[model samples]
Target: MAEDLVLDTAIRDWVLIPLSVVMVLIGVLRYFVSKLMRSSQSPDAKIIKEGQVIIRARNLRAGANFIPPKSFRARRAYFSNEENGLLFVPKGQAQNAQAQMFSDPNMAMDMMKKNLSMIIPQTLTFAWVNFFFSGFVAAKIPFPLTQRFRSMLQNGIDLSTVDVSYVSSRSWYFLNLFGLRGLFSLILGEENATDDTQRMMQMSGFGFDPSKSLGAEKDGLDIVQHEWALPKFEQRAEAVLKKLVS
Candidate 1:
C-alpha cells in the first residue's frame, strides 16, 4: 500500500490552469473549422429520397387507423404497388440510391474532410499536452478510481508510491477532452461540432443499426393490421353528450 502524499499548490497554478485554457482554446478552434468543412457539402438527392421513402411508409402505417377507410385504402394501394410504390419502385427512392450515394466521389470527399477535422485537432491537442506536460503528478480525482484506471489516469508517472487516484498532467488534458463537453456546448452552440463526441458516437455503429433492417417495410405495409378508429370516436362523443345531459 502507498502512503498518503500531499500534492503541491504550484501544480494547480502552473499545470492545471494552463491545461484548462488550452483545452478551451482547442475546442473553439474545432468549432470554426468544422463549420467550414460542413459548409462545402450540399445535401445529396439520393440520401434525401431514401429518408423520404422510409418516412412515408412509416407515416402511412401509423396514420392508417386514423384515416377514413376509402382514403386509407387509396394510400395503401399507392405505396404497395411494386411498379410505382416508394418502397417497391425501381431506382425511384433512397434504398436504390444507397449504393450510388455511398460510392459517390462527393460523399467520399465529405467523409474525408470530417475525419480530418476530428483527427487533426485532437492529435495536435494531445501531442501538445504530452510534449509540454509529461511525468508530473498534477492532480487527483475527488472520486475513487479502480486499479485498472491506474495506467490510463496516470500515463507518464510510474511511481508505485502514489495512489492511482493522483493523475498526471497528460491524463488531465484527456480528462478535459471528454469532461468539458458541457462547457464547450455552452461556448459553441449545441449544434456546433465542439468536441465531436456525438459524431464519433454516430460513426461507431450507434447512429444506424443494420440489424433493425427496413428491407421488410413493404411486407409490413402489405400485411398491416388496421382497424377503423373514427367510428369508435363517434360512439365515445355520443356517450359523453348523453352523460352531460343526464
Candidate 2:
C-alpha cells in the first residue's frame, strides 16, 4: 500500500480556498453580466397566448377530477378539440413556427449573448488556473478511491505514485467550476444563469421546444380520465353529518 502524502497547509489556504472563492465570485459576476446583457424584447402576442393555453391545459388536466364533468369536458375540448382547439396546430404549421423561431435575429442575438457569458468566464478561469496553480496537489479526498479516478482527480499532475484520492489544483478548479451549481443556486436564485451544465445542455440542443411542449400538453390533456370528485366529497360530508346526528 502506498503511504498517504502530507499536503502542505499553505496549499489549502492559498490555492484551494482562493480558487473556490474566485470561482464563486466569477459565477456570481457572470449571472449579473448575463442578466444585464439580456434583451428586453417584447414577446409576441401569439406566443404569449400559446404559452397561456398550454398552462391552462396543464392545469385542467391536473385538476380535472375537482371540476364538474361538463366543465371538465368543456375545458379539455378547448385545448384538444380536433377542429379549432388551442393546442391543435396543423402538422406543418408547427414545423414552420419552429423554423421561424430559429431564424429570428433577436433569438440568435440572445443565444450569442448567452454563449459569450458562459464561454468568456470559463476560458479565463481555466487559463488562470492552468497558468498559476498548475501541477500542485491542492487537496485530498477523505475516502479511498480507485485508480480510475486518478485521471479525473489529478488532472494536471503527472505522477504514477501519487494516490488517486489526491486532487490536483487544476482538477480542484474544474470541480469547483461544475460542482458549485448548488452553491450558486443558493446564492443566486434557481433560475440564475450561473449554471454551466445547464447552459452546456442548452447549447447542445436540449433547449425548450415550444411546439413539442404544446403537443405533449395536448396529448396529456387528451388522456386524462377525469372523474368528478365534488359529488363524492359532498356525499361523504353528508354521511359524516348523519353519523354525528345519530
Candidate 3:
C-alpha cells in the first residue's frame, strides 16, 4: 500500500488559490472581450419566420392527440405538404441558402472573432500554468479515486506511485477550464460566451445548421400519427364523477 503524500500549506495558498482566481478572472475578461468583438448583425426575416414555423409545427405534433383528427390533419398538411408546404424547401433553394451563408464576409469574420476569443486566452493561460507551476502538485481532492483518474488528474507529474486524488497544476487548470461553467452562469447569466466547453463543441462540427434543423422538424411532423383522445378523456371523467357520486 502506498502512503499518502503530504502537501505544503504554501502550495494551497499560492498554487491552488491563485490558479482558481486567475481562471475566474480570465473567464470574466473573455466574456467581455467576446461580447465587444461580436457582430451586431440583425437576423434575416426569412430565417426567423422559418424558425417560428418549425416551433409551431413541433407544438402541433406534441398536442396532436388532444386536437380533433381533422384539425390535426389540416395542421400537419400545412407544414409537411409535398407540393407547397411551409417546411418543404426546394433542394436548389436549400443549397443556395447554405452557399449564401458561407459566402457572406460578415459570417466568416464573426467565426474568426469567436475562434480568436476562445483560442488566445486558452493559449496564454496554458502557457502561464506550464511556465510557473509545471509538474507541481497543486492540491488533492477530498475523496479517493481509482487508477483510471490518475492520468486525468496528474497531467504534469509522471509518478506511478502518486495517488489519483492529487491534482497537478496543469491538470487543475484544465479542470477549472471546463468546470467553471456553472460559476460563470451565476455571474454572467445563461448562454454567456465565457464557457470554453461550448466553444470546443462548436469547433468539433456541432454548430447549428438551420437547413438540417428545418428538415428534421419537417420529418418529425410527417411521421406523427394523430389520434383524438377527447372521447376517452370524457369517458374517464364520467366514470370518476359517478364514483364520487356513489
Candidate 4:
C-alpha cells in the first residue's frame, strides 16, 4: 500500500483557490460576451412573426371553451380557414418546403452564439490550467470512491498506488465547470446568459431537442386532443339544472 499523500498549503492556496476563481471570472466573462453578441444579432422578423402567430393560436385554443360560440367560431375560422387562416396561406404565396428545414433559425443561431461563448472560454481556460497545473494533487474528498472513478477524479496525477479519493488539478477544472453555474447565477441576475449549466442540462435528455420540439408541436397542434366544448355544453348545463331542480 502507498503512503497517504498529504496536500500542501501552497498547492491549495495557489492551484485550488485560483482554479475556482478563474472558473467564476470566466463564467462572468462568458455571460457578458453572450449578451453582447446576441444584442448585435437581431432575430429574423419573419420568424418572430411566425412565433407570435403560433403562440396566439395556442392561447386562443386554450381559452376557446371559456368564450361564446360565435367568438369561438370566428377564432376557429381565423385559424383553420383555407382562404385566410393564420395557420394556412394561399398555395401561390406559400413558402418553399425546403425553407422550413429548421423551423426557427433564430433559435439555432442563439444556440450557436451561446455555445461559442461558453466553449471558447472553457477550452482556453482548461488548456491554460492543464498545461500549467497538471501533475498536482489538489485536494481529497472525504468520502471513499471506487477504482472506476480513479481516472476521472485524479486526471493529471499518475500515481498507481494513490487512493481514488484524491482529486487532481485537471479534474477540478471539469468539476468546477458544472458546479460554479449556481454561483454565476447568484452573482449575475437570472436574465444574464453567463452560465452554460442550463444549456448543458438542455443537451442532456431533459433539455430542448430541436428535432423533437417543432415536430412534436406541429403534431400536438394537429390533434389538439380537445373536444370542442360549445357543441355539447348547453346539453350538459340543462341536464345539471334539471337535476338541481328535482
In angstroms, how far off is 127's CA in candidate 2? 1.0
Candidate 2: where is the Cα deviation over 4 Å? 1-6, 194-212, 235-246
Model 3 spans with C-alpha error above 4 angstroms: 1-6, 142-165, 194-212, 232-246
Residue 148 local lDDT, model 3: 95
What tens digits encode model 3's per-residue C-alpha lDDT throughout 100-158? 66666776687778889988999999999999999978888899989999889999899
Off by over 4 Å in 1: 91-99, 185-190, 194-215, 235-246
Q: Give the TM-score of candidate 2.
A: 0.83
Error of 1 at 107 (Å): 1.4
Best by TM-score, which number? Answer: 2
What's model 3's TM-score? 0.76
Error of 2 at 92 (Å): 4.7
> Positional deviation of 55 in candidate 3, in angstroms?
1.5
Overlapping backbone residue pairs in candidate 4 total 2
Give TM per candidate.
0.79, 0.83, 0.76, 0.72
Lowest summed lDDT across 10 adjacent residues in model 1 is found at 205-214
- How do the residues 1-246 of candidate 2 rate in per-residue lDDT, one tens digit apiece? 569787889988889899999999998999999889988988878778889988888778888999999988988888889998889888877776667677778877877778898889999999999999998789988899999998999998998899888899999887897799889899898878855446657754725667788889988988888888777787899999999999
- The better-scoring model by lDDT among 1 and 2 is 2
lDDT of 3: 0.84
lDDT of 4 at 31: 80
